[model samples]
Target: MLGDMILRAFRLTVRVSAVVQSSCQCPALHSCRALHSSPVLWAGHNKWSKVKDIKIPKDAARARMIAKYTMMIRIAVREGGANPEFNVALAQLLEQCRNKNLPKATIEGAIKGAKSKQGAQYLYEASGPGGCMLLIEVLTDNNTRSHQEIKRIMVKHGGALCEGARRNFDRKGVVAASRDGISSEKALELAIEAGAEDVQETEDEEEKPILQFICDITSMKAVRSALESLGVHTLSAGLEFVSHTPSLLNHAQLETASTLLEALNDCPDVVRVWDNIHAQNSQGN
Candidate 1:
């Protein structure tokens, strides 16, 4: 009887050990399968996801740039005439569009749209973060809709539409040029000769060097012509509202202000957005 009981006990221990071993093996198999199957799939998925994320913003920015140029073309032709030869503004705008790789057909379509009274120009002003001001230019067929949309965006982005915000800015001609091949001294001399009020050198988001020439609003054409005659390529030459007293913001305030500006700029009707927020490191009130 004692021998039989001991044998039964040994059998029960074996059964329990087998059950535990099987449970452990099941998890090991599952883990092996997961590890082997997921690395390649996850890596590929992650790579594609990153590409998609980058491409989306780039494509959207390109679209916005095209749309802004299109609107400017339409406004130029409408205010003047479709004949580029007779309309200097339209001619300049056409050249600008071409520089941006805007399609010929798109330019022509914008001109045609202008003739049909498809849209009107509007200027909006709002107070943004850190006591900075914004000047938003828009072209839209519906004034009420544009106003409501712009107001909503401003309010949502920690800004509010304010009256007479333009008073804080000076309307002037701004000419932006790349400093790729031009020396600072040469740029300053040229700007002074062109009757520019100020010549400032700055870097773009990519840290590319840029030179800006500020002049009286009425002197843009002359300044632009002077630069072109000297074989200096201008990136952009147009009227802009520059802040007289720029507001300095901290990093957090700058982020919020930048977000608001980008949101305003992404609107289809918004052509350009100007702000009085000083550079990140600048000291201002």
Candidate 2:
């Protein structure tokens, strides 16, 4: 989507901005003006703000996902077996951990603890602004702590937790993949043939056009099986939100929002941050 392209452009511009700000010892005023006046720099900053206003909730969401996965791994071992070959969820989590390059010892320890039956399970939730929705995957022995943290983050970020957010999320599972050399139509066909509910494009300046497919939760396994049956190379595959309306931001506000989102994202508990921050054309917010 154009939003993804905007994000990539924003990131690149930010890197360039950082270089400019760092190398210019000539005058502080001159360097600041360059940052504010540069077209690319301004566009990037604006895009970032839109993302922050809508996409990112706070750090707590990530922290929650990590905790939930940890608990799930523990539960998987205690109930089925430590060896992933016999435990599907454990195997999937293991695959995810491996894909993310998580420490071997960490994965092993989670399994071992699960085998000991010393782990507790936690539920995940989503929250958002008035019309925004957030999906939060969390893990915690103390539900109160998790809930409070999530609530705090939402309030701090001009959003809140509510039962309503659940309505915005499609329980149907979705997977994201990329087709660098292929056209968007081709990617859509592959996904549809695999029984995908919907297919959307991804925007990446340097990479191939990315596509995402939505399928029934039960059909997700089938979709993956079919994709594998076709031998397609997917850049990423996971569940994500489909925002109703993407948000927008001004240039100055965008910069501030980007910082807020990054700060919140840096929190360990946060797992995934999604929002509709880019849905307009403008020079400022």
Candidate 3:
């Protein structure tokens, strides 16, 4: 779909290029000497603007995706090392990057940068709208600076730094698998057979269904292996601070909570922000 969209944009650009060239060949355009006036470059004044408008959103969305993937890859590299051949987490992440059509050059660049430096990891606990408890993860050389920036962003979004947020979360192993054609009953059965402590169903950024097989932090690789042997393609295997106490959010509260999350994630030093927010109408909230 992205390729087709780019092809369409290319065709439009080619058509516009011819129009621009024809204008450049005009005798009047060449003879014009007005200091305040410029020759018209295209058939429509908004043609270029329209092209930019068409391209910018796609590029921005793609950029956000790459940034997110880059962060994940960096964390994988930091935890497991840069060699995918020996790093199971990194290997799975690389496969996911390919599946999502991420550029090979971008992947390589991220891996290279990931090996350059290391930072102390920290977690910021906060409470947001709708009683949402947040665990904001940070990786930084300067803890004071990162803390100030995160606190500012949180406060700006009507949230504040808080204590006991970590108490609501438990670090556990998570193995994500595609939920295509997989029923709830089937997911439960898979979890049971794979020795997962629990299973949580969720959707990815693409709105595709996924099942997170949760287990002890040390059992991530084993559970992922079991899932794969059982014919379930694993998307990622990692440890996460899974929230145990969920906060139910109404429509307005949900909107505010989401905005707060976006703000938190935008901080460069912030790695991941886990929350215990569930919509009031869904997830038995």
Candidate 4:
């Protein structure tokens, strides 16, 4: 039902995001969040949003992939250094981008841009349809331009910039892992052993099952290490704004929320968008 309705948008907001914050109190960091209907409320997309992962053209997908990786690479360079050999994080990112088959020129260009001291990360908050809260993660060199653009996008899409949306969410650490051949019991066991508070199963665009482990933000790295030691293949480890209460949207609201997310993500500067929107269970109505 959702696939037919959600637009095919390009790259969007996620710092693994849409992770996370580095505690930069300076004019960076945007906020908004949730009330708690589910432990694992967001992971790339939630239950209702996942089915809407319809395919776009192969070229388009690759372009979007490249765009996302480009920003990620730039961020890594800005955080660490341009020299991947010295920056373990940058080296790992380069490997991941290579695995995605990002063009050599694109990778090189991102690295080159990082040396200019540009790339700053920010999050912007907005209220969407059904009053769903959204957090848009952005990576840009031009803060003023990006800010104005995001505000414009929000206004154009039935959304508006609003403060205090962050109250709805708890900033928690999230570790994504492979769910292949792993049962729920096994997932729980791993979560317990790794000191993760909870584990919820979701999927990628390809429908491959994924496990999202929730942990205290400070223990994020430790939890990931623990899981790896327990023989789990860790996909990515980062912080996320997990909602305490997910907003339940009616049909029209659901449709509008989907489009709003897509629109926010469409911005080239946007890294990823986090939200508290979930479809109202028809069974309950």
Candidate 2 at residue 20, lDDT?
Answer: 85
Error of 2 at 265 (Å): 4.1
Question: How do all models score by TM-score?
Answer: 0.75, 0.56, 0.71, 0.67
Q: How do all the candidates rank in terms of lDDT, highest first?
A: 3, 1, 4, 2
| Candidate 2: stretches off by over 4 Å | 1-72, 75-81, 115-130, 176-183, 201-210, 229-231, 235-265, 270-285
TM-score winner:
1
Q: Which lDDT tens digits does candidate 4 get at residues 1-285?
A: 565444332123434333444434433333322334234556535654544554344445567667877887888888888887788668767866654567899899889977775668987878988799988889987999999999988887788989988888889988888887999999999999999998988864334689999999889889999999999988776667888778888998888877877677668998778888877887845
The candidate with the higher lDDT, 2 or 4, is 4
lDDT digits (tens) for residues 193-281 of candidate 1: 87888887876433468888999988887887888787777877767677788887888888999899888987888988888787656
The number of the candidate with the highest lDDT is 3
Off by over 4 Å in 1: 1-47, 181-190, 201-209, 225-231, 280-285
Shift of residue 228 alpha carbon in model 1, Å:
4.6
Candidate 3 segments whose C-alpha is farther than 4 A from its true place: 1-58, 75-80, 85-89, 115-120, 281-285
Model 3: per-residue Cα lDDT at residue 222: 88
